[model samples]
Target: MKGVVILGESECSVKDFPDPVPDVGEVRVKMMATGICGSDLHLYHMDKQQAKKRGERIPGHEPCGIVDAVGNGVKKVKEGNRVTIGHWLGCGYCDQCAAGNIMWCEERRGYGGAIDGSHADYVIANERNCVLMPDSMSFIDGAFIACPGGTAYSSMKKLDVRIGDTVAVFGLGPVGLSGVILAKAMGGKVIGVDIIKERTELAKKLGADAVVNAKEDDPVKVIRDFTGGKGTPLAFEASGSAKGRTDIVSSLCRGGKAVFVGAGSSENVINPGQLIGSQLTLMGSFVIPLWMTWEMVDFISTQDITFEGAVTHRFSIDKASEAYRIFDEGKTGKVVFEWS
Candidate 1:
C-alpha cells in the first residue's frame, strides 16, 4: 500500500506502507476517494496547534470507499459494499455509544487525525464507524457523508432551525456552504456572509437567499438590514474566524440560537458581555452522530445535491505536497486525493 505522511514542519512525503487488514469488528476499505480537510493542510504545514497536539501526523478524515474485506462479527456490511467512514471512531460498548452519541465516547478517535486516514490506498475502520452507501453514489460524493455535510447536519440539529425562521451563515467555506443548503432545505430563509467574493457567489448557488461579501461591507449590519432590522432567528459561525463569531452573535435576533460549527484555534476570543446581552444560545457542535450522518446522506441522495463545487482541486497520491499547498492558499474548496 502507498500512503502520505507529514514527518514534521514542512516535511511530507508519500511512501509505501503495509496494507491494512480487518480485525474482529473491523473492515478493510479500499479507499476510493478522500477529501482533503482543513486539518490535513494544517498538519501538512505543521501548524502550531496540531503540531503541539499531535506531531508528524497523517491527517485526513473524510474518506469514502468500498469494503474490500470484512472481519468476523461485522454484520452490518460485507465485502464489495460502498461506504463512507465516519470521522469519529468510538467504543461501541460505552455508555455514550449506547445512548447513540458514540462520538462523545472517552475513547473516541478519528481517521487521518489520531490515526492513518483515507490519504492512502487502504485504511482499517471499526464497523461502528462505517456507513454503507448505495452503489449509485460516486466515491467523491460519498466522501462528504463524513464531514462538511455531517457537521452541517449536527449544527442544524443542535440549533433546531425551524421552518419560516431566518438563518444567517457567517462563512462561505464548505461547511458554511453546507449550512446554507441545509438551512434552506429546512425552509429557513438563508443568508450567507464571507470575505471572499467567489465563496459568496457560490453560497447563492447553494441556496442562500443573499450573500454578503464581508470584506467590502459590515456583515452584521448587512444581515440585520436583510432581516428587516430584526436580525436572523438563527445564525451559524462556520468560518472559524474570531471576527465571524462576533458577527454571528451580533446578527442574531434576541433569544436566537447561534451554532459554532467551525474548528478554530484555541486562542480565538469572543465577548461574553455581547452574548449575555443578546440572550443568545451559544452552541458548539463537532462531528455528527452516526445516525445523523446516515440521515444526511439519505437527505442529499434524494436531491441532485452536487458536491462538484466543493471539490475544487484534485491530486494523485504522489502530489500530496501540492494538495496541501493549494488548500493552504485558500483558493480552492475541498481538495481531494484520487486513487489511480
Candidate 2:
C-alpha cells in the first residue's frame, strides 16, 4: 500500500507501507476519494522536527470509498458497499457516543490526527463509522460530506436560516463556500466575505447573493448596507482569523445568531459588551454528529445540490506533494485526491 507522509514546511510525499488489516468490528475500505482539509495545512506547515514526530501517519480525514473487506463482528457493513467514514472514533459506551456525537467523547480518537488516516490505497475504519453513500452521489460528494461539507451543514442547521433572511458568511474557503451553497439551498440570501477576489468570485458563482472583499472594504459595513442597515440575521465564521471572527460578530443584527466553524488561531477577538448590547447568540459548531451524516446525505439528495463545483483540483495519490503545495497556496476551493 502507498500513503502520504508530510515532511514539514509545506512538503509531502507518497511512500510505501504495509497494507492495513481490519480487526474485529472493523472494515477496510479501498480509497475512492479523500479531501485535503484546512486542518491538514497545519500539519503541512509544521516545523521539520515537529513534522517528523508524526512519523508516517497519513493525513486525511475526509474519506469516501468502497468496502473491500470486513472483519469479524462487522454486520451492518459488507464488502462492496460504498461509504463515507465518520472520521472520529470514541468509546462505544460513552454517553456522547450513544448520542452519536463521538467527537465530544472524552476518549475520542480522530482519523488523520490520532491514527492513520485515509490518504492511502486502503484505510481501516470501524463498521459503525461507515455511512452508506447513495448510488446517485458521486465519490467526491461523499468525500466532502465527510468533513467540510458536513461542517457547513452543521453550522447552517445551528443558525436555523430561513427564507428571506440574510446570511453573512465570513470566509470563502471550502467550508465557507459550502455555507454559501447550503444556505442558498435552504432559502437564505447569502453574502460571502473574503479578502481574496478569486474566492469571492467563486462564492458568487456558487449562489451567494453578494460578496465583500474585506481587503478592500469593511465587511461589517458592507453587510449592514446590504441588509438595509439592520445587518444580517445570521452569520457564519469560517476564516479562523481574528479579524474575520471580530467582524462577523459586528455584522450580525441585534438578536442575530452566528456559528463559528473554522479553526486556526486562538485569539480573543470578540467583544463581550457588543454581545450584551445586541443580545446576540453566538455558537460554536464542529463537524456533524454521527447521526447527522445520514441526514446530510438525505438533505443533499432532496435539495438536488451538487458539491462538484466547489472542487477545483484533483490529483492521484502519486502526486501527493504537488497536491499539498497547491492547496497550501490557499487560493483555490476544495482539493481532492481521487482513485479510479
Summarize candidate 2's per-residue lDDT along 158-274 as a digit string, tens digits: 999898889999889999999999999999999999999989999999999999999999999999999999988999999999999999999999999999987877988889999
What TM-score against the true fold does each predicted structure earn?
A: 0.91, 0.98
Best by lDDT: 2
| Model 1 per-residue lDDT at 291 | 77
TM-score of candidate 2 versus the correct structure, residues matched by position: 0.98
Task: Give stretches of model 2 more than 4 Å off.
Answer: none
Q: How does residue 129 of candidate 2 score in lDDT?
A: 94
Query: Taking the tens digit of each residue's C-alpha lDDT, what string does model 1 give over 81-116?
Result: 888888777777888887657779998877887777
State each model's C-alpha RMSD to the native: 2.5, 0.9
Q: Per-model C-alpha lDDT, please?
A: 0.80, 0.93
